[model samples]
Target: RLLTKMFSNHLQKKLTTLSTLTDLTISLDGWTDNSGNSLYSFMALKENQEIVLDILDLLADHHTGNFLKDKLKEVLSINGIKILSIIACVTDNPSNIAKVCMGVSVYEQGFRYCLSLSETARPKYPEIENITIKNIISDRYHFANNDALTKVIKPIVDAIGRLESNDSTLADIFKELINIHQQISQLEVPINGLKAHALAIISKRAREFDSDIFFIALFLSPPHKFLAISRKMSGDKIIRASLELAKTWNFKKIDTSLLFKDLLSYKNNDPPFDTPFKSSSQSLRSYWSEFTGNAPLLHRFAMKVLVIVLHGASCERLFSSLGLIKSKIRNRLTPDNLSILGQLRNELKKTVHIKENSNKTVTEFSTYNKARPTGF
Candidate 1:
């Protein structure tokens, strides 16, 4: 009770300080736990703040799309989060996530084919795009259309998945899409003749992310400081994009005098944090940290845009810690108690000075509980 309350109150106070914050990315994903309970996970980040993972209970019986929408609204409302604050919602191509992204399904066919293709033997997609078989020859198209097609197409799919799983990946989507486009262009050539239609279906889905928000995400990242514009864009286009982004952030509106003169001057200049971190994941993490200190405006945009980690991998890892605290013997733990345990453990892990596995804190809690409850 004390542990969770302490950390919960502390974190809430921290979030309240983000009054000026906007465009926050909150990745929502749900899973069935070892106890067969359907629970959801959320990971929220903005600017230079640490990613906060929250495990929320899904008390309803069915997990339909509409139900999920209401549940999420409730969660966000309780946390005082705004829908407009979210830039993107990342999840493994699940139907529910698709529904959440848009009110309805846009890529149902593509999603179905993506799964069927992931397996060893491809599920019969019947007819895809322009390819058809009236006069039957061999089942080559049928058999090869599934897993083999998926294997050939995995380069693009896997790369995008890598981008999705990135801690600070939202900003890299557009740049990475360019990379995917290049990969597909490379693969499209070798895939001539009869198997061409399969490639078309795969390519269409890969190129579906045409939103400008993706490009904005790419532009904010330090490594790809400017999204790889060389393929379809020139220096002129680059300047235009920077100008527009600047305007979108109201940079020009704030200081209208030197709109082009101020920002465009740094146009081609390289950010000191451009290079990749050789070993640490925190390499990219450091870029925002450094920029926020010196450039608060750009930092705000970076925070507004950088968001996503769909598989709930971070949240799942959190569940493991929760498991340690609320073991089988402690299985009777209430949701409130479990939350405190989870948050307290998370708080402990965040600070190196606070020994996580140390018995001192646990012993102190034990002493306090025993002393208060006893007649002594």
Candidate 2:
């Protein structure tokens, strides 16, 4: 019971600190433990200072959404965790949890719009006057005696058909029709000279134009494909400069990789420390040599805490403690009592803070003294 109380105190402190400092990115996973009990694991960056793994919930054989939601609510209440700032959820393919609405499902579809703007060689002859040609090619030339233009638009119509009755995808089809009108706004060919070849060329270009539009739509998509384009742009100074044309009004977040590279290359021996510890501890020695040259003890301690805690082992150890405590007693536990026990176990691992005296110099002593009796 004493050990359990210490654990609770430690966990409470960590959870409080996490809530205070960092924007959290939470991931949840459910699994069966060795004891054949169902458990949900939650991991998050707490306070951006520490990574914490928590047994967010435990459940009986019959688990449901209500069970999950209730457990989430319970955690929030205990931690005083009001809002989730960022969330990343991972699950198996065709996961039912992917559903956003009842009886309605969404499937991601890939589309490419082909534009005729890029020419391999010299420019072709000027396109004939103002008929909107679409890229959709079909063998049929006419629909209800209207002409071949109507047949070219069948794909848009078909896409709209899949949507719910009178939905906005149907409206989007009409919007594309208007876009067609705008494309041929400058064409001046006489109606009588609208030859088969001219119509064919216009149709081809229209298809290409639709493809361009599709690509633009992809930029506004979820799981955006712009990262590849952004990477290419960053590689080209001219492209990056062009993107930053508006000096005052045009600013964008530089990609993190670019920012980190610039930060690391600030000086000949910058970036202070090497995280992966390569080559004989040379960089680390250089960092301390430079740091201890001027900085105080408090600064050294701050840096030490930052570096030592960066690795994920801290959270892993916490998880092991959770297993040690909860695995045997979970079936007999209540949620509230289990949460209390989890909190106590977490605190036991952290070092206690002892304030240094103002007048006296701090000194290290090596003698071991027993504060309490040891028992196996």
Candidate 3:
């Protein structure tokens, strides 16, 4: 309990330092354990920081949308985390779309159909009548159906993996989603099989990428701004929305009219910087950092909004670390101790600057010797 309190106190200090992040994107992810325990983890992402806000193991008989919404609101209401804006949400279970993604419905039908088999068609025994069914015939029929459908659905599954990959950023999702839709629409399914089912599943999700937060995040990226804006909203409307977002944050030194004019006339190929960055290897973040003085409000907005991760993989990331720590040889490690160890690991990763990590803390510190080392 003392250690948990210490971690909480440390979080408060970090929260105070990050108070300037008036705008935040919340990622709520839930996972179920083998023991039927439903656990929900909440994470908050800002311009330069990502932290696990809280973890709750709900004791409910079932998890529902109202339950999720209330728990999310409760976590953010504390922790000095106001302005609860959600840019994206991901789930192991695709039952609820609920402002999560623009077209989350596109992804739901495929999942729903997987569980729609009628009770009578499914029986514990191979046959109910006296005659036993031919096992080979039943197996082959299912295999043919699965083969046709799997070919279509595999790409969409791979696309989800890429989008949620640890290193992926918010800018990566838009193009991948568009490509998945194209692939889904072109699928040729068997006349009476799961191919059509598979197609509908992906096509539904493809068209659901309609969230305004998605467009704005993609718009902030110089490489994607033009292609990322939703056709539903005009270019002028996109500009207005971006500016309105800034005003809500009470951003400093924003000449709203000037910013609008500047964005209208801006060209990515010819950035305001004196030296054009030629190599495609140059990142958009670097470009925005250099252009801050020229377009202060615009730069700040891009820095904040574009920094969001496309998924909440960060919430589950600690599990891998925990697995390593609590291996078969060390499985007896207590939960509280494991939690502290995990926090220590993450807090270290966020260290900004380190002069000499291995330096001695006592009177004298030894540096790496330039001279030969033969082991004394």
Instruction: Output the number of the TM-score-best candidate.
Output: 3
- TM-scores of the candidates are 0.51, 0.32, 0.61
Alpha-carbon deviation at 164 in model 1, angstroms: 4.9
For 43-103, candidate 2 gives per-residue lDDT tens digits of 5533223333456446543556677667656665565555543322222222223122212
Instruction: Evaluate residue 75 in candidate 2 and report its C-alpha lDDT on the 0 to 100 scale.
Output: 61
- Which prediction has the highest lDDT against the true structure? 3
What's model 3's overall lDDT?
A: 0.60
Model 1, range 1-376, lDDT digits (tens) per residue? 6765687675776468444556665656665544555667666655334344456667555778888777677767766777766655555444322212231133546655564454434454333333243222124343334444444455555554575454546555555555655665555333355246644655575457544545445545545645444454544564466557556555545543353443333345535333454544554445655552334445544444453332344565666677687667777776556665676666566564445546678999988988795565
Candidates, ranked, TM-score: 3, 1, 2
- Model 2 regions more than 4 Å off: 1-16, 23-35, 46-54, 58-316, 326-336, 352-376
Q: Which parts of model 3 are misplaced by more than 4 Å?
A: 1-23, 32-38, 46-50, 60-145, 182-201, 221-224, 229-231, 252-254, 267-293, 318-376
Relative to the true structure, candidate 2 reaches a TM of 0.32
Higher-TM-score candidate of 2 and 3: 3
